[model samples]
Target chain A: MSEFARLEEKLAKLRQRERIAGEGRKLRGKGGDALLAALVAEIDETILPRRLSLVTPQGPVHLAVANRRLQALLAPVPGSLPEGLADHALPDIEDPKLAELGQSLKTLLAEAENIPVTARRLDRAFGSDIGVPAVQLPRIWTVAQPTAAKPDDILSGFLADLGDAALAWLRIEGEEVTLQGGEEAAVAALSEQAAIFLDSYFGKFDAAYREPSLACGTVIAPADGSANAVFFVEIGEFSAIIHAPAAQMPSIASDWQRRVAE
Target chain B: MDITAELDAMRVDVQGCALVAYTDLSSQLVLSTSAAANPVQEEMNALSQAAHLALDGAIAEGAAVSWGGETPAELAFLMTGAEVRLFLRSPANSSEALIAVCAPDVDLERAVSEARATLARIGGQG
Candidate 1:
């Protein structure tokens, strides 16, 4: 072929390839949405009916564990949930486009099952694979070693940077979160306030947060977790009290994290 | 100690204090309360109970675990479009909490400090 003819032929091929690639991109995006839709339909049709409700008249409690977040989905079935937790159930589970939920449910469930407990105290006290089975039915120990950063410097620095943006700042010492940067009396009273809030809040969960950085709202509570362990939270004007790991704050990146980011 | 006098004192200390109450979380009874436009008796009773639940209730337990199984938050402020409600647990005593309702634009830092001082005085007596 002549040089000009050859160039024209190459240009046509490029256009054709571009069209194919565009179509593929559309499919990839739709493919994710389609998968979530199918998953929702599968659970609504099969799982809901198959699993009889032990507590409520509807279906059984089925939470959607997105990656590490134990998200409370509005289970068609009712009972088996605390009143406060029940109130936290969000209606977005069935939405085709769940927030940042691009992964498949199968993958998320698998990850949720293997979030790595670290057995907090289990490994430290007794080395791995050395569990005992004595007494009777056999019991195992698995829970210990919090990775939360010491709040002293972090809280003070954060509070200083936060200045008046924060309503109050506190550091949890055992059973009380003593407010930082206050007089002896101010700290005492603030500490009491923080302690009572935590004591009452954790008391209700009856279990620790499975993963760190829950990022909870006042109305939308994520109650499903591992134990009554340590975590971080920021309650803001939006009425949202976001939770995350104590050692490190949650990744929400709202007003609270502004200082930490610096 | 004169509890009413104490609450009244707090009212004076707290600027733009809409209402101030010294509540017994256990009984949900307002021993002595002062408000610009006082809510009914039932409202105060409900406020006292709600304070207990929010500060030391089931959710607080979950929050405790999230906080490395240590003590939970001490000060919880309930924000709204119209006003702000603060719940402060006395370090000296857990059974009592000081509830204050203030205007939206009130100086919270100053308000919290003054409230803390007042709570210490009341809690000290008990």
Candidate 2:
């Protein structure tokens, strides 16, 4: 094949791989013991009235599964865990379903453990660290060149195209409610927006999952941390935006990494 | 916090991340590093500067160049057949960056993100 043809083929393969990644995201979204889905479900469960609670002198101490999962997630590194929350919250699992769930949780935790190793391996194969940064490449004229569009440009255009259909935002000032624009209006929303934007921009190649959703808006909770929430609006199978309080940012970032691991 | 300790925290999450070095942008001197015996400090800084300069040029041209490319310019490939190296620009200072050298199959995205996180923690701009 000609050099141009070879480059075209490589670009096509990359686009195809990106499409496959989108499909994989949908699969994970459907059901998996992977950290994000499980954590989200657990957090959602926490918001609901308790089905299981243990009565104590203090009060009816509700079972916090999210806390347990967090504990389990950090179990491998107990020393790193903050004090007061180090001890295991539950005694043990007796029920078979609960036991199986515990095993699944272990599996997810193991995957989290492998994140660093997997990242290193992928970096080597990708050799993103070894070559001249593409930004520095001499502009070579090509008969079949990939478009020079940056990922952000593509995302901005995509968000712009949404027009009135753009996602709406909610601003929560302390306990007060306010309306703001959606993910597009988020201050310092670049990295968060980039995630969904990349998924949608690439999803165009895989028409099966090409709809995009922007963040609904910020849902502010009182500083007490009782009613805080993270909202996700799925534009389609491919793109979605998550809105959460600033305090939850680290956990959310961890969840994103877990999804990437999956 | 010491740069080595910060890199260690990040290195634990990435398996093939062999070395993490912080270089002074102007002097091209390695301020701190995770490797026991880092021999290629000068080369890494030189290549990293080239990559960083290129990225800045792209940004100047309004080419929205985030670090998510199939082949980011920040990566260095040694023609002498050495391990792959990645250079991450500090978000705090344009001149300084955190360099990571890894095996060929390392997870580029997550590793880079972890390094970026560490950089952010150490008050470096990445």
In order, the Cα lDDT scores of the candidates are 0.40, 0.35
Q: Looking at candidate 1, what is the lDDT of residue A37?
A: 34
- The positional error of residue B52 in candidate 1, measured at the CA in angstroms, is 1.2
lDDT of 1 by residue, B5-46 (tens): 777887787787788888776676777787767688767766
lDDT accuracy of residue A111 in candidate 1: 19
lDDT of 1 by residue, A119-162 (tens): 01011122222211111101111112122232233444545554
> By TM-score, who's the top model here?
1
- DockQ, cand. 2: 0.01
Distance from true location, Cα of A180 in model 1, Å: 25
B-chain TM-scores per prediction: 0.86, 0.65
Tens-place lDDT digits, model 2, residues A121-221: 01112111221112211121111222333323333343343333323322221112222345444423432333333333333323312221111111111
Task: Provide the TM-score for each candidate, comma-separated.
Answer: 0.37, 0.28
